[model samples]
Target: MTAEIRLFPCLTDNFGYLIHDPATKATASIDAPEAGPIIQALEREGWTLTDILITHHHGDHVGGVAELKQKYKCRVVAPHDKAAKIANVDLRAAQGDVIKVGGLLARVLETPGHTLDHVSYVFDSEKALFAADTLFSIGCGRVFEGTYPMMWDSLLKLRVLPDDFKLYCGHEYTASNIKFALTVEPDNAALKARAEEVTRLRSENKPTIPTLLGDEKKANVFLRADEPSVAASVRMKGQSAADVFGELRERKNKS
Candidate 1:
């Protein structure tokens, strides 16, 4: 059976997700940005909180963990990296680990870049990827604790996923990300179309998430850093893809 997913806004731009398995009635919060919205969503959906799958140690991501755990007595799963120091973790997962939330299974992928202990969860059967912080709709998280090359490597991990996989990211930065993306590939037809779509979505106050990996591969310049066209756009024709990606990231930082 397919899992039921709920998306809601939390703490300004952060997006909170609830993945529920109908067969087992097991529900897991992807990350707890805050307890209020998650609690409200649980109440609205009539689903008991069974687990919390944390992606990183960021405050906005883990801020609600304590309260939610106290309320529901649910399992809290976090990265195995002791350095992350996330509180109330019941299970610590590493790369290639498979976490079972009732009948649904999520494979763990170590995708550090925005932070040293960052990870992303992939529900292969569901074609869903919860890539908090590391990957966004049209952009990626900043290389705060890792090297640019390391960040590029992390992006590559997610990039290799099936094209049909649906990406559920951490924040609502698509509008801004698209604006910056246009500077790198103004002539890209797919990007231009996506820009228009993003404009319409934001105008309607709708979420631009659950984007297909295929669409991102075609329009997101960050994901296309290895492409010859992307290299030419940044005037780094012969440079390695990692260097080109670094240049693109630097430009995004200043944008």
Candidate 2:
């Protein structure tokens, strides 16, 4: 059976996700920005969280892990290299590891960029990707601890997935990302249209997440480093894709 998923806002811009497998009544939270909101969401859905699947060790992502673990004794799962930094992690996972949420299953893909220990979870059967901060809507994460090439390689991993995959990133950064994306691919019709739609959505206080990989391929400038237009925008035309990507990341850092 397909897993039921719920998304809610947490902290200032962070997003919290809940996935439930009805067959076993097993539910998981992708990241815990805070306990009160996650707790409320669990209660509202009548699902007890049995797992806390972390993508990275960022404070906003793991802040409420202690509270949730105490309340439900949920198994805390995080990246192996950084598990010690995250409180209450019961399992340390790396690339190729498969995690079970009741009857549902997800494969871990190590995607380092925003952080060295970053990883993304892909539930192939459900076509859902808990990308966390690695791959956001219309943008990819900043290369903080990792190099630009490392971040570009990490993004390439996701680019190979089926275009229909749904991306559930960790924050509500679409509007701002779109704005920055436009600077690189001003001629992208799809990007322009998506920006207009995102503008309307934000004006209405709607969430702009769970974006389609297909759409991002066409609209996200960070993913379009291979495109001539993006290269031209940064005056790096004819450069290698990695070089173009590095330039784009540099521009966004200043943006």
**Lowest lDDT block of 10, candidate 2:** 80-89
**lDDT of candidate 2 over 103-163, digit per residue (tens):** 9998999998789999899999999999999899998888888888889999999999999
- Candidate 1 local Cα displacement, residue 40, angstroms: 0.5
| lDDT (tens digit, per residue) of candidate 1 on 15-127 | 99999999999999999999999999999999999999999999999999999999999999999998878999999999999999999999999998899999899999999
- Model 2 misplaced stretches (Cα beyond 4 Å): none
Output the lDDT of residue 138, model 1: 86
CA lDDT, every prediction?
0.95, 0.91
- Reference-based TM-score, model 2: 0.97
Model 1 residue runs over 4 Å out of place are: none
- What's the TM-score of every candidate structure? 0.99, 0.97
Residue pairs whose backbone atoms clash in candidate 2: none
